[model samples]
Target: MARLVRLVRRYFILGSGLHLVACGGGDSTEPPPPVTVTITPASATVNAGETQSFTATVTHATNPAVTWSATGGTITGAGATITFAAPLEGGPYQVTARSVADPARSATATVTVRAIAVTVSPAAVTIGAGGTQEFTATVSNSTSASVTWSATGGTIAGTGTTITYTAPATGGSYTVRAASTVDPSKSGSASATVTPVAVVVAPASRAAFRGEPVSVSATVTGAAVTGVNWTASCGTIAGAGTTVTWTAPQSPGNCTVTARSVLDPAVASVSMMTVRPAFLVTSLGDANDGVCSWTHCSLREALTAANADPGTDTISLVVPAPVGAAVANTIVLTTSLPAITTPVHIVGPGADVLAIDADATAGSPRRIFEFDGAFAGSLAGLTLTGG
Candidate 1:
């Protein structure tokens, strides 16, 4: 009985074969027909820990017995059905089926076992800004034992398990990957990154009166760790800090301020500012109820504008006495005033008429006039007393 279950259903495959059978029985004894065995699927590739079914067809012989064997790996089957199990590693192999009746006749198919996985070593890496590192890939279950390499944001060299990498000059993230040479689809990957080391300065622009102090700041990042070296093109830097003081030149002009990393001279930042002659007070605003440029006639506003100006600005007091109410001559300050940083004269109507009363509620009066070391200004005709 010829038991044919089904055609090949993906177990693995074998090459096709051609055979002719001639059976003639007229004399009393009859000879057996020639037996041809063929395994479907001439060639195939499969991953490890996987299975593919191979079907065999018996030609010429009725109730034929066929045996399946492999050059590598394992197979399981009965009758004309055989399952070829791929090895854990990747390699080229062969599968064959032979007719038991005609031991000399056989059919063979090619098999290539594929790697289950390929893992790139050093799963994660970090590199300094403009640095370099090496990478490697390890392939699992591959008899071929070979891999191709690649990467992002940098140059990679060499092949197989080991390779060289040159990091990007700037700070950022990057990765490396390895693919199995035998099985292109089977691959693994790794990662690397570049970090930045430098410093930055701020207050991109500013203005100060000649002989006045200019305020600026600096920030350090990445590698420039120790501190900053400050420099001024047209003035003298008085001190060192994230925020620093710079005295302007006696002649009105422009200046460039810079902060360089103590660690790396190549990394630095700069700011620009101008110096002017003098700034005269514009509005003798009594708007001291709140803080603003307009509406609130607070001296805070007057002085803030004066300090913010780039020149030697003056703050002259001239009160517009409200018609109905007594002229509010006393400028009572509840909070401490901002430090004066420019060269400007502070003049008033009279020492008695225009008084800067530092405290009305506090037991002790606060200082009313705070000066920057570089401020060159005159105070007259104004009575000022503060704690």
Candidate 2:
């Protein structure tokens, strides 16, 4: 009975040991996580010729490095981070990052590129003052090819790419600008020069003495080329450009001075000038002679010559000293002077020094002067006695 009890205890201990072994409670093992790649900024939009950066996150990967690529444009850099450069062409492009550890597990990012450009046709132009010009704008690499137009000077009319520019009444330099409707920053410009079409000459009418010099000037409005061409109908023009000297001719007549625009020959202005004749009386003798020489002219001779000349005439007296010391400074008229038929102005020395005496004791008493026909004349600085 004692031996059987000991054997039963031994069998129970062996059974517990076998049951623990069968449970299998040693160190445990688990499967590694699957390799995956994810990219930041899955989608983006940028302008052409621009740059963008992308980073890739690789999970459960033995090597975190990645190779960069793109469907279009250039891609640079290495590792998880890379730079993408967009091309000049406008379109949608793709950027991809493949894990070096697992090429099958890669990430892709969409990059849309846009190229915008603007241009102006007939970039430079010149127009007359108060004139209008048409301009057009062209846009590229855009679905909406419309543009906005503006001018630095003058009035702008119409809308869209095509518009009209009306120059101001005054002339100057100006600019016309065209900007894209989608992108205002991208724009183009054109140069404009507004010129004057009219030429104006100052002093529309004037009266001048023969052989006199007159100053004439012209104003040219809104012209890129300034100044004018001076011309005279009966006088000589001196100098050039906007201002000139006009010397009246010796003959007395009506003259016209013209200033023509250098830019437009058809545009011109004219000024009317009246020329009058003048005479000088060097002798105080009362001889009723009709001839008056240039060097020695008597008062009576000056009067006769003035009546025959056209237009208004002027006579100035300058008496010579008598040969005898007792001779007086006087014109002793024997007969009436010639009748004045035209308008004439007679100017003498001082009234206190010179005198016209009509007292005739031998023949019939005569008057110092006579006027015939309807005319206007003047006598100044002369004493009349004994008519």
Candidate 3:
């Protein structure tokens, strides 16, 4: 029996040894812990006014919580996210993820932020007094942004790109500025100027007759003139249209007229006219009775005698006189005509010569009257009157 037991034991030992060989049971070999690294998204590229963020994560981390930092960008909430305040700025950044098992074992990551830019159209604008002007500003990159526009000591009309502003009370210079919530550092500015326009009027040099109508005109010059104002010196007429009629007073005399532009009250013009007196003739002296004759003596001889006669020196010219009447007669005098004074001697009579007088007619022939006389100022003789 002892011998049999021994044989069994030996078999068992040999089987165990074979089993161990087949299992290959030694501790399994594993790749060294993978080199820990942190994963982080680069800082977001934002437009001048838009907001952006940067985040970090652990590549193969046991814990997701990580510490983040931006050299220039702003970090928020547990240092895992970074915000670009103004626009993305250039700079080196890093993030780290640490394991609880081995605080010493940590992973790190790198991030970069890009910059944003903007543009504006019609950098400047001009407006008239009591007027308004409009312009636009454009953001080149980014969306979902906030902006602040300030007219430094000036009035801001609207928000965002399209804006309208009222001109200052007077004419002068103004400044404007723009800022974005996302990018405080990114800002822009522009300038505007305003000016005033003028109007003018011109008048004629001469005035018209009592019944005549004159023209008065005005002109507007400068930025933008819409309407004009007209005025007259005397007669009644329409104020509208380029011209206004002017009438002279019944009394002949000097008159002045003026026209002015409404836009510019300062500019204006003027005109003048003069009136004269008029007259008519009524009666004249006779030639017969020793006064004057037209028989042998020509009309010139009769005029010479009348003009040389001292008593009638100041007498005025008149139409129609008796052929054989006394010297006394009435006549009409011209307003501007001068007085005549001279002495004359009558020689012809019935014995030696004959004499006759007659009234001058409107259609009297010119050669019918002839005169040769000396007198002070102008003289109208009987023959000259065609009598």
Candidate 4:
């Protein structure tokens, strides 16, 4: 038992010496792994005031978010997806996305900024003279909404984004333009085609005596106007064009001349005319035949004779009868006479004894006294039947 206790004391002393050697060096924790960053869509091209997306990927990263920045643009929203907006002035720029976990670890991408493009609405249009058209300018990748407007023809109204284009009074093709205020160098243009307009005419007033010659004149405006059509309400317009010779109707009163535009059929003008009166006839004949006399004759013969005379005359009437006898002075006829075209006044013997009986020509319905539409005259002291 004494030998076993000596051996146990020697083993305990050896274990203490080995433990002191192992505890002399070496740390319990190791340093973190090095991080590296990478970017997606390594390079891109975009217009001024345009937005583009960028992504950042980090290996061995400790933080979940990435800090976004640009050397010449605006940046928004960080992390893997970053939004970068190009500057208003176009140029090359560098966009960087850095790892939030390690400031030293970051990635960059190249961005090319291009000029903005402008477009115009209603690129082309057609209108008649004195018409108007409206145009608009739309700018892509622009920072402002306003635009300046101008035109090569007619008038213009308004200044910003929208503008009105008024066509010239004369017809032709015209040009209109809109310039972008955001980018002065960029502009949009449009074309306007104007068509012909309608025309109008005017005529003058006139007055003349019967059988006298008269004329009318008129002028026209608007579309290309040549000659005009001529017409008369109570006379004859004899000429072919704008100026016409007017012959007063034998039987006349008030009249008018209408001038119509030849180039534009819808346009017309009118002038007033007046004709004076002449001649008065008192007929013994009941017939419309131009016969005139002082004694017992049919009313038709009196008119025929009066119309043949040079100057206006009145027919004094006396019914033919047996001398010194109370025989009836009734006159009858059997044939139709020409119309009473001239003015006249028929005076009979008396209303009681001067009955121009239609008994001789009453075999059928007939006109005892008929006046032409132009005749303005009177019939006194006569009883006419079957007229």
**What's the distance in Å from true for residue 63, model 1?**
22
Return the TM-score for each candidate structure: 0.37, 0.45, 0.43, 0.38
RMSD of each: 20.0, 10.9, 14.8, 15.3
Candidate 3 per-residue lDDT, tens place, 119-143, comes to 4446776765435666565554545
User: What is the C-alpha local distance difference test score of candidate 1?
Assistant: 0.70
Model 3 lowest lDDT segment of ten: 276-285
Per-candidate clashes come to: 22, 5, 12, 23
True-vs-predicted CA distance for residue 101, candidate 4, Å = 10
- Candidate 4 lDDT score relative to the true structure: 0.69
Question: Is candidate 2 or 4 superior in TM-score?
Answer: 2
Q: Which stretches of candidate 2 lie over 4 Å from their true place?
A: 1-35, 44-48, 60-65, 88-92, 99-104, 112-186, 190-195, 203-209, 212-217, 223-245, 252-256, 260-268, 272-387
Candidate 2 lDDT trough over 10 residues, lowest sum = 319-328
Candidate 3 achieves a global lDDT of 0.46
Q: What TM value does model 3 have?
A: 0.43
Instruction: Report how far residue 320 has shifted in candidate 2, in Å.
Output: 26
Q: Highest TM-score: which candidate?
A: 2
In model 3, where do residues sit more than 4 Å from their true spots? 1-39, 42-44, 49-53, 58-64, 71-74, 79-118, 124-134, 142-160, 163-196, 208-212, 231-237, 241-243, 246-387
Give the per-residue Cα lDDT of candidate 2 at 343.
87
Regions more than 4 Å wrong, model 1: 1-94, 97-112, 126-128, 143-148, 157-160, 170-172, 180-186, 193-198, 202-220, 223-250, 258-387
